[model samples]
Target: MISGVVVKHFLYCPAIVRITELGFEERVTDSMMEGEEVDKETVGNFLFGVLKAKELIRKPVYKYKDLVGSPDFVLGFSYYYSPLDVKYTNQVHMDHKAQVLFYAFIMEKLGFNVKQAILYYIPVKKLVKINYTNYEREYVERILRNIVKAKKGFLKVRQPVRKCANCGYFQFCKPKRVGNFYEREF
Candidate 1:
Protein backbone atom coordinates (compact mmCIF):
# COMPACT_ATOMS: atom_id res chain seq x y z
CA MET A 1 0.00 0.00 0.00
CA ILE A 2 1.30 3.44 -0.96
CA SER A 3 1.29 6.04 1.80
CA GLY A 4 0.50 9.75 1.59
CA VAL A 5 4.20 10.58 1.44
CA VAL A 6 4.52 8.32 -1.60
CA VAL A 7 1.52 9.97 -3.23
CA LYS A 8 2.95 13.41 -2.46
CA HIS A 9 6.24 12.47 -4.06
CA PHE A 10 4.49 10.92 -7.04
CA LEU A 11 2.51 14.11 -7.53
CA TYR A 12 5.62 16.27 -7.08
CA CYS A 13 7.34 14.37 -9.88
CA PRO A 14 6.23 11.42 -11.93
CA ALA A 15 9.85 10.26 -11.93
CA ILE A 16 9.60 9.71 -8.19
CA VAL A 17 6.69 7.34 -8.70
CA ARG A 18 8.78 5.41 -11.21
CA ILE A 19 11.73 5.33 -8.84
CA THR A 20 9.61 3.84 -6.05
CA GLU A 21 7.99 1.36 -8.40
CA LEU A 22 11.50 0.26 -9.34
CA GLY A 23 12.21 -0.21 -5.63
CA PHE A 24 14.82 2.52 -5.41
CA GLU A 25 15.18 3.70 -1.84
CA GLU A 26 16.39 7.19 -1.11
CA ARG A 27 19.85 7.25 0.46
CA VAL A 28 20.60 9.80 3.13
CA THR A 29 23.16 12.28 1.89
CA ASP A 30 25.56 14.28 4.05
CA SER A 31 23.81 17.52 3.20
CA MET A 32 20.26 18.09 4.35
CA MET A 33 17.53 17.39 1.85
CA GLU A 34 15.41 20.47 1.26
CA GLY A 35 13.35 21.38 4.32
CA GLU A 36 14.50 18.50 6.53
CA GLU A 37 15.63 20.39 9.64
CA VAL A 38 12.90 22.98 9.49
CA ASP A 39 10.20 20.32 9.31
CA LYS A 40 11.49 18.67 12.47
CA GLU A 41 11.82 21.85 14.49
CA THR A 42 8.48 23.28 13.46
CA VAL A 43 6.62 20.09 14.20
CA GLY A 44 8.01 20.16 17.70
CA ASN A 45 6.92 23.74 18.21
CA PHE A 46 3.46 23.04 16.80
CA LEU A 47 3.01 20.13 19.14
CA PHE A 48 3.93 22.31 22.09
CA GLY A 49 1.55 25.11 21.16
CA VAL A 50 -1.39 22.86 20.32
CA LEU A 51 -0.95 20.76 23.43
CA LYS A 52 -1.09 23.88 25.58
CA ALA A 53 -4.23 25.23 23.88
CA LYS A 54 -6.26 22.10 23.23
CA GLU A 55 -6.04 18.33 22.95
CA LEU A 56 -3.76 17.24 20.14
CA ILE A 57 -2.71 13.91 18.73
CA ARG A 58 0.77 13.86 17.34
CA LYS A 59 1.55 11.59 14.43
CA PRO A 60 -1.61 9.55 14.52
CA VAL A 61 -1.37 6.82 11.89
CA TYR A 62 -4.41 5.96 9.83
CA LYS A 63 -4.83 3.41 7.07
CA TYR A 64 -7.49 3.21 4.40
CA LYS A 65 -6.79 0.38 2.00
CA ASP A 66 -3.72 1.25 -0.16
CA LEU A 67 -3.47 4.63 1.59
CA VAL A 68 -1.66 4.92 4.89
CA GLY A 69 -0.51 8.14 6.58
CA SER A 70 -0.04 9.93 9.87
CA PRO A 71 -0.82 13.60 10.07
CA ASP A 72 1.72 15.65 12.03
CA PHE A 73 -0.94 16.84 14.44
CA VAL A 74 -4.66 16.37 14.83
CA LEU A 75 -6.26 19.16 16.85
CA GLY A 76 -9.09 17.60 18.77
CA PHE A 77 -11.99 19.79 19.85
CA SER A 78 -15.18 18.83 21.61
CA TYR A 79 -16.75 17.29 18.51
CA TYR A 80 -14.20 17.39 15.68
CA TYR A 81 -10.58 17.04 14.70
CA SER A 82 -8.56 19.10 12.21
CA PRO A 83 -5.58 17.87 10.22
CA LEU A 84 -2.42 19.94 10.51
CA ASP A 85 0.88 19.43 8.75
CA VAL A 86 4.22 21.11 9.39
CA LYS A 87 6.21 22.11 6.34
CA TYR A 88 9.48 23.96 5.88
CA THR A 89 8.54 25.66 2.65
CA ASN A 90 7.38 29.25 2.75
CA GLN A 91 4.43 28.49 0.53
CA VAL A 92 1.96 25.63 0.49
CA HIS A 93 2.09 23.12 -2.36
CA MET A 94 -0.60 20.92 -3.83
CA ASP A 95 1.23 17.89 -2.54
CA HIS A 96 0.97 19.27 1.00
CA LYS A 97 -2.74 19.89 0.56
CA ALA A 98 -3.24 16.41 -0.87
CA GLN A 99 -1.47 14.81 2.06
CA VAL A 100 -3.53 16.70 4.60
CA LEU A 101 -6.74 16.17 2.67
CA PHE A 102 -6.12 12.44 2.61
CA TYR A 103 -5.90 12.47 6.40
CA ALA A 104 -9.01 14.62 6.62
CA PHE A 105 -10.89 12.18 4.39
CA ILE A 106 -10.06 9.30 6.70
CA MET A 107 -11.04 11.34 9.76
CA GLU A 108 -14.30 12.50 8.18
CA LYS A 109 -15.25 8.93 7.34
CA LEU A 110 -14.77 8.11 11.03
CA GLY A 111 -17.50 10.67 11.81
CA PHE A 112 -15.22 13.57 12.61
CA ASN A 113 -15.81 17.03 11.19
CA VAL A 114 -12.83 17.87 9.03
CA LYS A 115 -13.55 21.15 7.31
CA GLN A 116 -10.06 22.24 6.27
CA ALA A 117 -6.38 21.39 5.97
CA ILE A 118 -3.89 23.50 7.93
CA LEU A 119 -0.22 24.01 7.13
CA TYR A 120 2.38 25.60 9.36
CA TYR A 121 5.18 27.01 7.28
CA ILE A 122 8.40 27.22 9.25
CA PRO A 123 10.17 30.08 7.53
CA VAL A 124 7.13 32.31 7.33
CA LYS A 125 5.75 31.30 10.71
CA LYS A 126 2.24 31.38 9.33
CA LEU A 127 -0.59 28.92 9.05
CA VAL A 128 -1.81 28.54 5.50
CA LYS A 129 -5.35 27.43 6.05
CA ILE A 130 -7.05 25.75 3.09
CA ASN A 131 -10.60 24.55 2.88
CA TYR A 132 -11.08 20.98 1.77
CA THR A 133 -12.89 21.67 -1.42
CA ASN A 134 -14.48 19.02 -3.62
CA TYR A 135 -12.10 19.96 -6.43
CA GLU A 136 -9.05 19.26 -4.29
CA ARG A 137 -10.61 16.07 -3.00
CA GLU A 138 -11.17 14.87 -6.56
CA TYR A 139 -7.62 15.74 -7.42
CA VAL A 140 -6.29 13.67 -4.53
CA GLU A 141 -8.65 10.85 -5.42
CA ARG A 142 -7.21 10.73 -8.93
CA ILE A 143 -3.67 10.56 -7.61
CA LEU A 144 -4.55 7.70 -5.26
CA ARG A 145 -6.42 5.84 -7.98
CA ASN A 146 -3.43 6.11 -10.30
CA ILE A 147 -1.18 4.79 -7.56
CA VAL A 148 -3.43 1.74 -7.25
CA LYS A 149 -3.31 1.24 -11.00
CA ALA A 150 0.47 1.40 -10.93
CA LYS A 151 0.56 -1.32 -8.32
CA LYS A 152 -1.57 -3.45 -10.66
CA GLY A 153 1.16 -3.59 -13.35
CA PHE A 154 0.60 -0.27 -15.09
CA LEU A 155 2.97 2.60 -14.33
CA LYS A 156 4.66 5.32 -16.35
CA VAL A 157 7.95 6.88 -15.33
CA ARG A 158 7.78 10.65 -15.39
CA GLN A 159 11.06 12.43 -15.99
CA PRO A 160 10.45 16.15 -16.05
CA VAL A 161 13.48 17.61 -17.76
CA ARG A 162 13.53 20.77 -15.68
CA LYS A 163 13.42 19.10 -12.27
CA CYS A 164 16.38 16.76 -12.77
CA ALA A 165 18.95 18.87 -10.95
CA ASN A 166 17.17 18.90 -7.59
CA CYS A 167 15.98 15.30 -7.82
CA GLY A 168 17.72 12.65 -5.73
CA TYR A 169 17.69 10.33 -8.77
CA PHE A 170 19.36 12.94 -10.99
CA GLN A 171 22.69 11.11 -11.21
CA PHE A 172 21.01 7.94 -12.38
CA CYS A 173 18.46 9.56 -14.65
CA LYS A 174 20.57 12.24 -16.39
CA PRO A 175 17.43 13.51 -18.06
CA LYS A 176 17.67 15.89 -20.99
CA ARG A 177 18.16 19.38 -19.65
CA VAL A 178 15.41 21.99 -19.78
CA GLY A 179 14.85 25.45 -18.32
CA ASN A 180 12.78 25.80 -15.16
CA PHE A 181 10.11 27.63 -17.16
CA TYR A 182 9.93 24.98 -19.87
CA GLU A 183 6.45 23.66 -20.45
CA ARG A 184 4.91 21.43 -23.08
CA GLU A 185 1.51 22.43 -24.41
CA PHE A 186 -0.93 19.61 -24.46
Candidate 2:
Protein backbone atom coordinates (compact mmCIF):
# COMPACT_ATOMS: atom_id res chain seq x y z
CA MET A 1 0.00 0.00 0.00
CA ILE A 2 1.23 3.50 -0.88
CA SER A 3 0.95 6.56 1.34
CA GLY A 4 -1.08 9.67 0.52
CA VAL A 5 1.90 11.70 -0.64
CA VAL A 6 3.20 8.87 -2.78
CA VAL A 7 -0.21 8.42 -4.34
CA LYS A 8 -0.58 12.14 -4.87
CA HIS A 9 2.78 12.23 -6.62
CA PHE A 10 1.78 9.34 -8.86
CA LEU A 11 -1.75 10.59 -9.54
CA TYR A 12 -0.83 14.17 -10.36
CA CYS A 13 2.36 13.30 -12.23
CA PRO A 14 1.09 12.05 -15.58
CA ALA A 15 4.47 12.47 -17.23
CA ILE A 16 5.92 10.10 -14.68
CA VAL A 17 3.18 7.62 -15.45
CA ARG A 18 3.70 8.04 -19.18
CA ILE A 19 7.43 7.37 -19.38
CA THR A 20 9.00 6.39 -16.06
CA GLU A 21 8.19 2.79 -16.88
CA LEU A 22 10.77 0.34 -18.18
CA GLY A 23 8.70 -0.02 -21.34
CA PHE A 24 10.33 3.23 -22.50
CA GLU A 25 13.42 1.05 -23.09
CA GLU A 26 13.46 1.84 -26.81
CA ARG A 27 13.98 5.52 -26.15
CA VAL A 28 16.39 4.77 -23.32
CA THR A 29 18.44 2.64 -25.65
CA ASP A 30 18.71 5.38 -28.22
CA SER A 31 19.96 7.87 -25.60
CA MET A 32 22.92 5.64 -24.82
CA MET A 33 24.69 6.40 -28.10
CA GLU A 34 25.31 10.12 -27.54
CA GLY A 35 26.79 12.75 -25.18
CA GLU A 36 30.02 13.01 -23.12
CA GLU A 37 31.20 12.69 -19.53
CA VAL A 38 30.75 14.89 -16.48
CA ASP A 39 32.83 14.89 -13.28
CA LYS A 40 33.04 11.84 -11.03
CA GLU A 41 32.41 13.82 -7.83
CA THR A 42 29.31 15.20 -9.42
CA VAL A 43 28.18 11.67 -10.13
CA GLY A 44 28.90 10.56 -6.57
CA ASN A 45 26.86 13.34 -5.02
CA PHE A 46 23.89 12.35 -7.13
CA LEU A 47 24.18 8.73 -6.12
CA PHE A 48 24.45 9.71 -2.47
CA GLY A 49 21.31 11.81 -2.60
CA VAL A 50 19.32 8.97 -4.11
CA LEU A 51 20.71 6.69 -1.45
CA LYS A 52 19.32 9.06 1.16
CA ALA A 53 15.86 8.48 -0.22
CA LYS A 54 13.97 5.31 0.42
CA GLU A 55 14.75 2.64 -2.11
CA LEU A 56 11.95 0.98 -4.02
CA ILE A 57 11.35 -2.57 -2.86
CA ARG A 58 10.75 -3.33 -6.48
CA LYS A 59 13.54 -3.37 -9.12
CA PRO A 60 15.02 -0.02 -7.99
CA VAL A 61 12.88 2.07 -10.27
CA TYR A 62 13.90 5.63 -11.12
CA LYS A 63 11.96 8.38 -9.36
CA TYR A 64 10.63 9.79 -12.62
CA LYS A 65 10.36 8.49 -16.20
CA ASP A 66 10.39 10.70 -19.27
CA LEU A 67 6.86 10.90 -20.56
CA VAL A 68 8.21 13.24 -23.26
CA GLY A 69 12.01 13.13 -22.90
CA SER A 70 14.87 11.28 -21.26
CA PRO A 71 15.53 12.22 -17.64
CA ASP A 72 18.06 10.67 -15.28
CA PHE A 73 16.80 8.70 -12.29
CA VAL A 74 13.38 9.36 -10.68
CA LEU A 75 12.90 7.93 -7.18
CA GLY A 76 10.28 8.97 -4.64
CA PHE A 77 10.38 9.44 -0.88
CA SER A 78 7.55 7.39 0.60
CA TYR A 79 8.21 8.64 4.12
CA TYR A 80 7.75 12.32 3.31
CA TYR A 81 5.67 11.46 0.29
CA SER A 82 7.89 13.69 -1.74
CA PRO A 83 9.68 13.51 -5.10
CA LEU A 84 13.46 13.19 -4.98
CA ASP A 85 16.18 13.16 -7.64
CA VAL A 86 19.93 12.67 -7.60
CA LYS A 87 22.20 14.93 -9.67
CA TYR A 88 25.94 14.36 -9.71
CA THR A 89 28.16 17.23 -10.72
CA ASN A 90 31.55 18.67 -9.82
CA GLN A 91 30.45 22.26 -10.05
CA VAL A 92 26.98 23.80 -9.73
CA HIS A 93 25.69 24.20 -13.24
CA MET A 94 22.00 24.22 -14.16
CA ASP A 95 22.26 25.01 -17.87
CA HIS A 96 22.76 21.39 -19.02
CA LYS A 97 20.16 19.86 -16.72
CA ALA A 98 16.59 19.48 -17.94
CA GLN A 99 15.24 16.19 -16.62
CA VAL A 100 15.84 17.27 -13.02
CA LEU A 101 14.02 20.54 -13.63
CA PHE A 102 11.27 18.65 -15.43
CA TYR A 103 10.80 16.45 -12.38
CA ALA A 104 9.97 19.57 -10.38
CA PHE A 105 7.48 20.56 -13.04
CA ILE A 106 5.77 17.18 -12.95
CA MET A 107 5.77 17.24 -9.16
CA GLU A 108 3.94 20.57 -9.07
CA LYS A 109 1.48 19.56 -11.81
CA LEU A 110 0.86 16.38 -9.84
CA GLY A 111 0.26 18.39 -6.60
CA PHE A 112 3.27 17.53 -4.49
CA ASN A 113 4.49 20.32 -2.25
CA VAL A 114 8.06 20.37 -3.48
CA LYS A 115 9.84 22.72 -1.16
CA GLN A 116 13.51 22.28 -2.13
CA ALA A 117 15.75 19.74 -3.84
CA ILE A 118 19.16 18.32 -3.04
CA LEU A 119 22.09 18.55 -5.46
CA TYR A 120 25.31 16.71 -4.72
CA TYR A 121 28.59 18.01 -6.09
CA ILE A 122 31.05 15.13 -5.86
CA PRO A 123 34.35 16.97 -6.26
CA VAL A 124 33.15 19.67 -3.95
CA LYS A 125 31.63 17.04 -1.72
CA LYS A 126 28.81 19.37 -0.96
CA LEU A 127 25.03 19.26 -0.86
CA VAL A 128 23.20 22.06 -2.61
CA LYS A 129 19.57 22.30 -1.68
CA ILE A 130 17.01 24.29 -3.66
CA ASN A 131 13.24 24.26 -3.58
CA TYR A 132 10.74 23.77 -6.35
CA THR A 133 9.13 27.15 -6.02
CA ASN A 134 6.68 28.88 -8.33
CA TYR A 135 9.51 30.45 -10.27
CA GLU A 136 11.26 27.14 -10.81
CA ARG A 137 7.98 25.49 -11.67
CA GLU A 138 7.22 28.10 -14.28
CA TYR A 139 10.68 27.65 -15.76
CA VAL A 140 10.29 23.91 -16.02
CA GLU A 141 6.80 24.28 -17.46
CA ARG A 142 8.13 26.56 -20.14
CA ILE A 143 10.75 24.00 -21.13
CA LEU A 144 8.22 21.17 -21.20
CA ARG A 145 5.82 23.23 -23.25
CA ASN A 146 8.53 24.06 -25.74
CA ILE A 147 9.40 20.37 -26.08
CA VAL A 148 5.81 19.36 -26.65
CA LYS A 149 5.30 22.10 -29.18
CA ALA A 150 8.45 21.16 -31.04
CA LYS A 151 7.34 17.53 -31.16
CA LYS A 152 4.01 18.45 -32.76
CA GLY A 153 5.69 20.73 -35.27
CA PHE A 154 8.09 18.08 -36.56
CA LEU A 155 7.02 15.16 -38.70
CA LYS A 156 9.14 13.08 -36.35
CA VAL A 157 10.29 14.10 -32.90
CA ARG A 158 13.96 14.82 -32.38
CA GLN A 159 15.81 15.21 -29.07
CA PRO A 160 16.64 18.61 -27.65
CA VAL A 161 20.34 19.59 -27.36
CA ARG A 162 20.60 18.34 -23.76
CA LYS A 163 20.19 15.10 -21.82
CA CYS A 164 21.06 12.99 -18.76
CA ALA A 165 24.79 13.52 -19.20
CA ASN A 166 25.85 13.22 -15.58
CA CYS A 167 23.40 10.44 -14.96
CA GLY A 168 24.13 6.74 -14.46
CA TYR A 169 23.18 6.85 -18.11
CA PHE A 170 26.55 8.00 -19.51
CA GLN A 171 27.47 4.56 -20.80
CA PHE A 172 24.09 4.44 -22.50
CA CYS A 173 24.27 7.60 -24.70
CA LYS A 174 27.69 7.50 -26.39
CA PRO A 175 28.19 5.81 -29.75
CA LYS A 176 26.65 8.74 -31.62
CA ARG A 177 24.27 11.69 -31.37
CA VAL A 178 21.02 11.00 -33.12
CA GLY A 179 18.71 13.62 -34.71
CA ASN A 180 19.80 15.67 -31.69
CA PHE A 181 18.39 13.30 -29.01
CA TYR A 182 18.32 9.60 -28.16
CA GLU A 183 17.51 7.49 -25.12
CA ARG A 184 20.17 5.75 -23.05
CA GLU A 185 19.58 2.35 -21.54
CA PHE A 186 22.01 -0.11 -19.99
Candidate 3:
Protein backbone atom coordinates (compact mmCIF):
# COMPACT_ATOMS: atom_id res chain seq x y z
CA MET A 1 0.00 0.00 0.00
CA ILE A 2 1.12 3.54 -0.66
CA SER A 3 1.13 6.07 2.15
CA GLY A 4 0.30 9.76 1.79
CA VAL A 5 3.97 10.67 2.24
CA VAL A 6 4.99 8.47 -0.68
CA VAL A 7 2.37 10.11 -2.84
CA LYS A 8 3.75 13.51 -1.88
CA HIS A 9 7.24 12.57 -2.97
CA PHE A 10 6.01 11.19 -6.26
CA LEU A 11 4.12 14.39 -6.94
CA TYR A 12 6.76 16.86 -5.79
CA CYS A 13 10.06 15.15 -6.55
CA PRO A 14 10.67 11.86 -8.29
CA ALA A 15 14.35 11.69 -7.30
CA ILE A 16 13.38 10.08 -4.03
CA VAL A 17 12.13 7.07 -5.92
CA ARG A 18 15.27 5.10 -5.17
CA ILE A 19 15.03 5.84 -1.47
CA THR A 20 11.45 4.71 -1.32
CA GLU A 21 12.34 1.58 -3.26
CA LEU A 22 14.95 0.70 -0.66
CA GLY A 23 12.28 1.00 2.02
CA PHE A 24 14.47 3.60 3.71
CA GLU A 25 11.99 6.19 4.81
CA GLU A 26 13.23 9.24 6.56
CA ARG A 27 12.15 9.74 10.13
CA VAL A 28 9.85 12.72 10.55
CA THR A 29 12.15 15.41 11.92
CA ASP A 30 11.66 17.12 15.28
CA SER A 31 10.32 20.35 13.82
CA MET A 32 7.80 18.53 11.65
CA MET A 33 6.62 16.41 14.56
CA GLU A 34 6.31 19.52 16.75
CA GLY A 35 4.34 21.24 14.04
CA GLU A 36 1.80 18.42 14.12
CA GLU A 37 1.44 18.76 17.87
CA VAL A 38 0.92 22.48 17.46
CA ASP A 39 -1.63 21.87 14.75
CA LYS A 40 -3.59 19.57 17.04
CA GLU A 41 -3.38 22.20 19.76
CA THR A 42 -4.60 24.89 17.39
CA VAL A 43 -7.59 22.75 16.44
CA GLY A 44 -8.33 22.25 20.10
CA ASN A 45 -8.20 26.00 20.71
CA PHE A 46 -10.91 26.68 18.18
CA LEU A 47 -14.44 26.12 19.45
CA PHE A 48 -16.49 27.75 16.73
CA GLY A 49 -17.78 26.93 13.27
CA VAL A 50 -16.76 23.66 11.60
CA LEU A 51 -13.66 23.77 13.77
CA LYS A 52 -15.92 23.09 16.69
CA ALA A 53 -15.54 19.79 18.51
CA LYS A 54 -19.03 18.61 17.59
CA GLU A 55 -18.15 18.63 13.89
CA LEU A 56 -14.81 16.90 14.25
CA ILE A 57 -14.49 13.12 14.08
CA ARG A 58 -11.57 11.27 15.62
CA LYS A 59 -9.76 7.91 15.56
CA PRO A 60 -10.69 6.43 12.23
CA VAL A 61 -8.47 4.81 9.58
CA TYR A 62 -9.83 5.05 6.09
CA LYS A 63 -8.72 2.57 3.45
CA TYR A 64 -9.23 1.38 -0.10
CA LYS A 65 -7.51 -1.43 -2.01
CA ASP A 66 -3.77 -0.53 -1.80
CA LEU A 67 -4.55 2.96 -0.39
CA VAL A 68 -4.61 3.78 3.33
CA GLY A 69 -4.49 6.92 5.43
CA SER A 70 -5.48 7.97 8.91
CA PRO A 71 -6.53 11.57 8.73
CA ASP A 72 -5.61 13.64 11.78
CA PHE A 73 -8.78 15.75 11.82
CA VAL A 74 -11.96 14.57 10.15
CA LEU A 75 -15.10 16.64 10.61
CA GLY A 76 -18.28 14.51 10.56
CA PHE A 77 -18.54 11.02 9.09
CA SER A 78 -21.60 9.56 7.39
CA TYR A 79 -23.06 10.72 4.16
CA TYR A 80 -20.01 12.99 4.14
CA TYR A 81 -16.90 13.85 6.14
CA SER A 82 -14.69 16.89 5.84
CA PRO A 83 -11.00 15.94 5.98
CA LEU A 84 -8.80 18.65 7.47
CA ASP A 85 -5.02 18.50 7.13
CA VAL A 86 -2.84 20.96 9.02
CA LYS A 87 0.48 21.88 7.45
CA TYR A 88 3.43 23.92 8.65
CA THR A 89 4.33 25.51 5.31
CA ASN A 90 2.78 28.87 4.67
CA GLN A 91 2.38 27.99 1.00
CA VAL A 92 -0.03 25.21 0.07
CA HIS A 93 1.69 22.74 -2.26
CA MET A 94 -0.12 20.54 -4.72
CA ASP A 95 0.95 17.44 -2.83
CA HIS A 96 -0.90 18.66 0.26
CA LYS A 97 -4.08 18.93 -1.74
CA ALA A 98 -3.53 15.48 -3.23
CA GLN A 99 -2.89 14.00 0.21
CA VAL A 100 -6.16 15.15 1.72
CA LEU A 101 -8.10 14.45 -1.42
CA PHE A 102 -6.75 10.89 -1.35
CA TYR A 103 -8.13 10.58 2.18
CA ALA A 104 -11.48 11.93 1.05
CA PHE A 105 -11.46 9.38 -1.75
CA ILE A 106 -10.85 6.64 0.77
CA MET A 107 -13.69 7.93 2.90
CA GLU A 108 -15.93 7.83 -0.13
CA LYS A 109 -14.83 4.29 -0.94
CA LEU A 110 -15.78 3.27 2.58
CA GLY A 111 -19.38 4.34 1.88
CA PHE A 112 -19.38 7.99 3.01
CA ASN A 113 -20.11 11.20 1.22
CA VAL A 114 -17.05 13.41 0.84
CA LYS A 115 -17.63 17.06 0.27
CA GLN A 116 -14.17 18.60 0.59
CA ALA A 117 -10.73 18.56 2.15
CA ILE A 118 -9.30 21.39 4.26
CA LEU A 119 -5.69 22.37 4.70
CA TYR A 120 -4.70 24.68 7.55
CA TYR A 121 -1.39 26.45 6.98
CA ILE A 122 -0.01 27.15 10.42
CA PRO A 123 2.57 29.78 9.55
CA VAL A 124 0.19 31.98 7.58
CA LYS A 125 -2.90 30.92 9.52
CA LYS A 126 -4.72 30.17 6.33
CA LEU A 127 -7.33 27.52 5.71
CA VAL A 128 -7.60 26.32 2.11
CA LYS A 129 -10.62 24.24 1.17
CA ILE A 130 -10.26 21.79 -1.70
CA ASN A 131 -13.63 20.49 -2.77
CA TYR A 132 -13.62 16.89 -3.86
CA THR A 133 -14.38 16.59 -7.52
CA ASN A 134 -14.30 13.90 -10.18
CA TYR A 135 -11.17 15.37 -11.72
CA GLU A 136 -9.22 15.13 -8.46
CA ARG A 137 -10.20 11.53 -7.89
CA GLU A 138 -9.07 10.61 -11.36
CA TYR A 139 -5.82 12.53 -10.98
CA VAL A 140 -5.00 10.88 -7.66
CA GLU A 141 -5.75 7.44 -9.01
CA ARG A 142 -3.40 7.96 -11.93
CA ILE A 143 -0.64 9.02 -9.59
CA LEU A 144 -1.31 6.11 -7.26
CA ARG A 145 -1.15 3.67 -10.13
CA ASN A 146 2.16 5.12 -11.29
CA ILE A 147 3.50 4.88 -7.74
CA VAL A 148 2.55 1.23 -7.59
CA LYS A 149 4.26 0.61 -10.89
CA ALA A 150 7.41 2.37 -9.68
CA LYS A 151 7.38 0.32 -6.49
CA LYS A 152 7.17 -2.90 -8.46
CA GLY A 153 10.18 -1.89 -10.63
CA PHE A 154 8.04 -1.71 -13.72
CA LEU A 155 9.07 1.93 -14.21
CA LYS A 156 12.66 2.95 -14.66
CA VAL A 157 14.17 5.37 -12.13
CA ARG A 158 13.57 8.84 -13.47
CA GLN A 159 16.66 10.89 -14.14
CA PRO A 160 17.45 13.29 -11.33
CA VAL A 161 15.86 16.66 -11.89
CA ARG A 162 16.25 20.17 -10.50
CA LYS A 163 14.35 19.39 -7.30
CA CYS A 164 17.06 16.94 -6.27
CA ALA A 165 19.23 19.83 -5.04
CA ASN A 166 16.89 20.44 -2.15
CA CYS A 167 16.01 16.84 -1.36
CA GLY A 168 17.32 15.08 1.75
CA TYR A 169 18.43 12.15 -0.41
CA PHE A 170 20.47 14.41 -2.66
CA GLN A 171 23.81 13.39 -1.24
CA PHE A 172 23.01 9.73 -1.20
CA CYS A 173 21.58 9.60 -4.69
CA LYS A 174 23.80 12.05 -6.50
CA PRO A 175 26.61 13.48 -4.44
CA LYS A 176 28.67 16.26 -6.04
CA ARG A 177 32.00 15.79 -4.32
CA VAL A 178 34.26 13.69 -6.50
CA GLY A 179 35.38 11.48 -3.61
CA ASN A 180 31.77 10.82 -2.55
CA PHE A 181 30.77 9.93 -6.08
CA TYR A 182 33.64 7.42 -6.42
CA GLU A 183 32.85 5.96 -3.00
CA ARG A 184 29.24 5.31 -3.95
CA GLU A 185 30.21 3.58 -7.22
CA PHE A 186 31.08 0.33 -5.45
Which candidate ranks first by TM-score, i.e. highest?
3
Name the TM-score of candidate 1: 0.76
Per-residue CA lDDT of candidate 3, range 1-186, in tens? 777777887776554554577766666789978767766756634622545434666536877787888766787634567777777777989989888888888888888778888888877878888989998889888988777766655443433444444566665555344422211221
Q: What C-alpha lDDT values do all the predictions have?
A: 0.68, 0.41, 0.69
| Candidate 1 structure quality by residue, lDDT tens digits, 73-119 | 78775665678888877887888887888888777666677777777
Task: Give Cα distance to truth, residue 68, candidate 1, Å.
Answer: 0.5
Segments in model 2 whose C-alpha atoms lie over 4 Å from true places? 1-82, 95-97, 152-186
Looking at model 2, which ten-residue stretch has the lowest summed lDDT?
1-10
| Deviation from native of the Cα of residue 138 in model 3, angstroms | 0.7
Tens digits of per-residue lDDT, candidate 2, 94-125, equal 54233445545555555555565544544566
- CA shift at 37, candidate 2, in angstroms? 16
Colliding pairs, model 1: none
Off by over 4 Å in 1: 29-53, 150-160, 172-186
Per-candidate TM equals: 0.76, 0.42, 0.80
Residue 155 Cα positional deviation in candidate 3, in Å, after optimal superposition: 4.3
Candidates by TM-score, descending order: 3, 1, 2
| Candidate 3 Cα outliers beyond 4 Å, as residue runs | 29-35, 44-53, 77-79, 154-162, 175-186
